[model samples]
Target: MSKQYRILGVIISLAIGLAILPIKLTSEDLHSGNLFLAARTIRYTFTAGILAFLLHLYLNRTIFAARWIMVEYILRIIVIALIICLTSIVVDAIFNKFVKESSFTIAKEDLNWYLVILRCLLVSTVQFFVVFYLQLVEESQRRRLEIEKLNRSQLEANLSNLKEQMNPHFLFNTLNTLSAITNDVKVKDYVSEIANVYRYMLIHNKLNLVLLESELSFINSYLYIIKTRFGNSLNINIRIDESILPTKIPPLSLQLLLENAIKHNVASLDSPLAIDVYNDSENIIVSNSLLPKKTNYHSTGVGLNNLLNRYQLLFKQDIIIEQNTAVFSVKLPIIKS
Candidate 1:
């Protein structure tokens, strides 16, 4: 605990002690008169306040670790009541032994144990609520911090993905392809498709989720660029249900998967790279044949990892990956808008 909170506790204890002084003085008779009564009231108030403060401190730590709310609260209340009862008995005994004609003696046969227990129970109940409210405030603050941290991390990831997409290598490769295509008509079309791909990236990269139809349309433009570069060596098949078109997904998810397939696998006239995109009942499935290249592709695994993080942050869902000697596949959960 900070010095500030400790000071607050002291102030609160003193305030509570002052508040109960009148009740204690009025309820008991002091043979020595008002001075003795006042002294006893001060002692009683101080004891109660200290007990309450100590109970709060102990519970502040224990309550967070406790499971089963009802059981924990019941146990805490019983413990608090017992502590208060024992402390009151001790205080009363001290006063009876030293103070002349102190009426608040627990040793007396007429001393009402029922009222003592009732008072202890009432105080414990109030203490329990105070601790409960503090716990709620602590929990709310913790949640707010977690949300802020998550948002910061998510923004960084989005920026990294955008940088990856706009890298000079990708732009250079597309320009290189355009330069080699001698036909003016086809060159114009390819340039248009490349523009569309980058335009989509610029527009939707910052968003958490985009409509499935919009993503599909973006992927078509992305594929057009890829197909222009690879020609007959690459083949992509897409089969999606129109009903799921209105669903939402992380932008560029399909494009990332497709890029991963192309980057890591062999694509040629002899051995064409085959990729399939379709919708299962609950997921959008992306599967490609596992044809490894002789020269291993340098990959940092950032794209798929970023996609995983985005999926978890957005929907609390995991993208399923299935792989074997012949095929590699991923199942992205279709989140409803």
Candidate 2:
């Protein structure tokens, strides 16, 4: 109902309670102290107070969970207003209809809704501040956690970039120096290939994602070095469609996978390691034969973790890794051009 009408009803009830109620109840009724009247007053007061308390708890628990505090606060006010207004109406109706005295006539003042609304606003304001303060504290704590996380991520990204720069550039410069000193064509070409691999890394390491074709070119240079190192013991195959070459992935992803496979597995002439690279409709698959070395190779999970972090940061996507008795494989998601 409209506020004015609600106020009008309260004014009419106020006229009855103030003017008529005194005329209805004389000094004799007041001195007698009727047990029924006292019981009802206690019942209604306790019930209303308890209901408001419960409502406050309910609203605090459920409403404060929302992201926007103002929205929740407004919602609480609306809800509280409706509940209190409706409850006052119900209680007043019950009291007037059910509770009767033989001394007074049928009609008498029941309740003053204006007073109820005032009390509701007062209680609502108190609870709002309490809940709002708690909400503020909670939000402050959440923001602090987020800031801490962001700072940690920034530090890690800086560290990763540092690693990218120092490792690659050092190798690149070292290889260039070796190339200058080399006399033989085979040694010079090998050094050049290694330089090429490091150069590719230095150039693309800053990028969030690289086109598949560019990554594959880097992989080609990287594979040459691996092949030169391992010879016939490593059989690495690539069979990716040209259509998906335009798709994108985090830089160093394939290289990391290849290095992970080579690092963790036993590559020997007696037991050659077979690594395969191909693409399905959704993902690029990297698979290698499982041949664990007896030697304790420290598995820090740096390479795969780096790839996972890069992909998640760039695209909010996860790379799939699977292994069994025979083959260990990873599926890198393809981000379309």
Candidate 3:
């Protein structure tokens, strides 16, 4: 048995033993009889207490089916009753042999041993049910917690897979943009910048979170490629607090938001699409003026969905999205270290 159970057994036994003392001392037989008979009564009460504790400990370790519960309890009651009766008889025999002048007896006429046996059975039955009920409740709670943990683990795995899929799509789009550049010199420089962007993606994609500063540096490399392609048509502004540099965010989160703005909106010499990145007390805000393309561009919104799922897994905070006829905005929470 565990140490905790051992300690509990000792405590319960002592409590019952002490509670019987005053009643035994006030009995006419015990008060009038010599000190020897009084001592024996106390010993018997303590022995019954110990026996009740043992029965409780034994029943806790044994398992019974629902159909067999009553049968098992009846069996326990019979066994404890027999043990208490045998103990009383043995102690009486020993006392009688030592003190022949005043022979102590637990005989039916003298001491009513049946009542003592009945009390032992009752206490044992009550203690067994109390412990059984507590164990049932504890096991049920343990199972519930395990199920919740399993569900959370499965969700995290799905979000990680979604984030990893973005890498290939991003590489494909960057390569497609590079293919259209006509200037050989400009193409060579853009190729170097694209290489740096890919290197960052490969190194950090496996991680759940990255420092905001590191992600911003990667965004700068990505913006270089975008600025080369769109020229004066795209205008991106950034205003972030240096104190929040140590904060963490999912990798490529900002890049995905900026890409979404450029994908759906019109950005040309006549109508420049301006995107702004800034931070508030709790979140990093990405906003842009809405000027949707005249021609329909098939869009799936996979990137934004992937970001939302990733944030849900990493933190409890929600990613806020707001839109109107004139502008669109998304707020990403900054995870503190």
Candidate 4:
């Protein structure tokens, strides 16, 4: 959420208050010295502005939590605004009907619900657009700055990468040689899958997005390596729509989820771990039954956090997480084709 949005709410309300002040004044009213009318006009205008601004801030904070879907966000804003407007009118009507008017809540006859709601809606809608534009600009600038920082970091690491990087060509050649010379067919297949996993990482590490099919293919190879290590103790089921094959996602994103499940859970021949990857209407879901290992496991949460940050920065979407004693699930939004 933007701190500027919160701070600007009061400032904008004050501005609106002042803007509506001139409309409140008339030559005859000023000449006649209608102090009560003057005070009521100013009070009502400022109160409405302040109320709307506060509501804007609260709703903006609540709804726009790392998930910046434009359509949904705008719809929510409009819906909440209408609700607040209607609620205000009903409350005012109730107060007028039941409560005695003294110093405050005076000039009930002068209050026009239609005009007041219209004015509030107009001012609030304009202010919302202004703040939303500012937020978008701030986010764009922040993203650019981050990208520049990452570029600088990559440059600094270039020398280290050169020194530490194993030549992929040589590694592939060696793996192919081992696979060719292996006496056992299973060992040959295992060697080939290991090569595939490494090759996918080397090829797609720098890419921002890859087709789901490509990522899933890489995952299959990666899973082969894992299954070889865990044997029948681990089972992975992936059922994705073929139509979604063209959809894009951050490369290696699913690997992080799969890795987390394998790392944290108890997977043995008995009570084998089951990890399921499937897709619904708009999202891909990864789910597993809850099975915590007895051994103390320290979690830094880097993998999932890294995945989350990438999605927010790249897609402006938040991954939905749901967990219980029985199952843990994450719904990852799929990028449109």
Candidate 5:
């Protein structure tokens, strides 16, 4: 509803309540001779109009909370009654010159102005609560929308990070294999391994997950390139069960772990490195013996961090990492398609 219409509605409701107050207050039937009744009605109309405008300000603008509803209602009742009674007495005194005033007073009989004030209080309290409830509902909906927006932004950031990591990893390994092939005479086998590895990485790197068998075959082709380059030094053992070959796993996940192993560990013909790949109870396991490479440059630790971030983005679960005196292992959960 428009603001103007809502303001008009409040005015109409107050006018009706003020109009009815006089008839309800009179002990006898409402009649023309009852000057007091008419005067009281005019006084109430002025008081209620002022109170309604003040209430609109309080309900919409005030930051204070009503901790004690009963106390608030009682105070409002007292204030409205005092304002109306004072206005009525002044209006009666002013009308003495223009018209005759009623002399039949109710000093002998007892009256309770508190009851009428309480009735007005109940109506005002109900209006306040309705407005408060609607505002709370609007705030709740706004917060929910904000949370969804944050989640979408986080997912986009993770996807971009994962995309960026795959390219450099493939480039460095391919170039290294090419450099090794320059000195050796195994051109045909080296070229074949490079072709197979590049073809698979290009096709699957952008995807979130691929079948366990497909990822394994890609990892095997990658290991082939690494092994051909390192020749007699890189030892890889696969212990996968054929039963879960169709399950889904993150694309190029195994290749990343294998790269980390080769980058950080020592591997030569004299002390050949051992790397193991297997699956156990819905997880892919990659473990390698610790033999730090003295000649390699220090890494900035982006590979493992990238893997952790991607796993959290896709699964909302932590990948298990365990390291001890002789071995370091990582366990990745398999997500079934």
Candidate 6:
């Protein structure tokens, strides 16, 4: 049986044993401090054991079936009481065995089987209350855990949705810039690169992983769009090890880092923001010079928080961020799917 089954058995057993203790103590010979009191108690406890076993069997069947009919409850209590009375009689028989040799004769009469049955019923009712109370507590705990698990799942779903929204928003911004640069035929090849980035994002946005080469190519297309918008004001560079090109990364991760770089820092002709993408050891590092754009609206930190939460769900690691007056950088671990 499972640990839960064992624990439940132990709980029921302890409760029944305690319930029967007072009855055994009040028995005629028990209060007289007879030498065989311990033996009698043990013998009588067998009946309580049988009753407890029956209770477990009945409850195991009824509880999880979502069936709590009044008749079933009444029957279970009756069965439990019968077992207790049977065990009490057995203990009395044993006690009489030792007492037979002595001259102690209290009341010699036929066993009051009806009264014994009534006593069993009363004790069973008490045991039922205790067991029912414990079951309620256990059910409450299970419901609490279920609610917590549901909340966790909902949070993850919400984060995934926000990440999905970000992809299109980023694409719309980039596509708008590409549309404005139609007259510049000299950057046609670069325009194709930007188109390829949108193509990949459109195709693979729902995917969990993409090859590093594919993702980097997408990043280049994305950078092309950013460059078109800022012109000479923004400078971006990439230096990746060819060996790691086949590695897998979460989709649109690099885009979020780039967005953060642009959103927070100034990019202009006077102090052009240079964003770098490269590999150092096992980390994919995106570093940019800290030059805040002299604009009234800076940025809310939600984008990065969403990205960090997304990474945590997928990779179980935080997206490392470092910033100073002159520089700001983020390190994302390259992982294989």
Q: Which candidate leads in TM-score?
A: 1
Residues 44-74, candidate 6: write the lDDT tens digits. Answer: 4445654655464557445433365666678
Q: For candidate 4, lDDT tens digit of each residue in 254-289?
A: 987998898899999999999999999899999998
Candidate 5 residue-wise lDDT at 207: 73
lDDT head-to-head 1 vs 3, winner: 1
lDDT of 6: 0.70
Give the range where candidate 1 is weakest over 10 consecutive residues by summed lDDT. 101-110
Error of 3 at 120 (Å): 20
lDDT of 1 at 231: 91
lDDT of 4 at 244: 89
lDDT of 5 by residue, 66-167 (tens): 687666555654554455455544654465545553443322221355654554554455444444555566668766775665456445545755565557
What TM-score does structure 4 among the candidates reach?
0.58
TM-scores, one per candidate = 0.61, 0.57, 0.50, 0.58, 0.49, 0.51
Per-candidate RMSD, Å? 8.0, 10.7, 15.7, 8.6, 14.2, 12.7
Worst 10 residues of 6 by lDDT: 101-110
Report the candidate with higher lDDT, 4 versus 6: 4
- lDDT of each model, Cα atoms only? 0.76, 0.70, 0.74, 0.73, 0.66, 0.70
- The top-ranked prediction according to lDDT is 1
The residue pairs in collision within model 4 are none
Error (Å) of candidate 1 at residue 17 is: 13
Cα error, residue 278 of model 6, in Å, equals 1.3
| Clashing residue pairs found in predicted model 6 | 266-291, 266-292, 266-293
| Residue 204 lDDT, candidate 6, scale 0-100 | 74
The better candidate by lDDT, 5 or 6, is 6
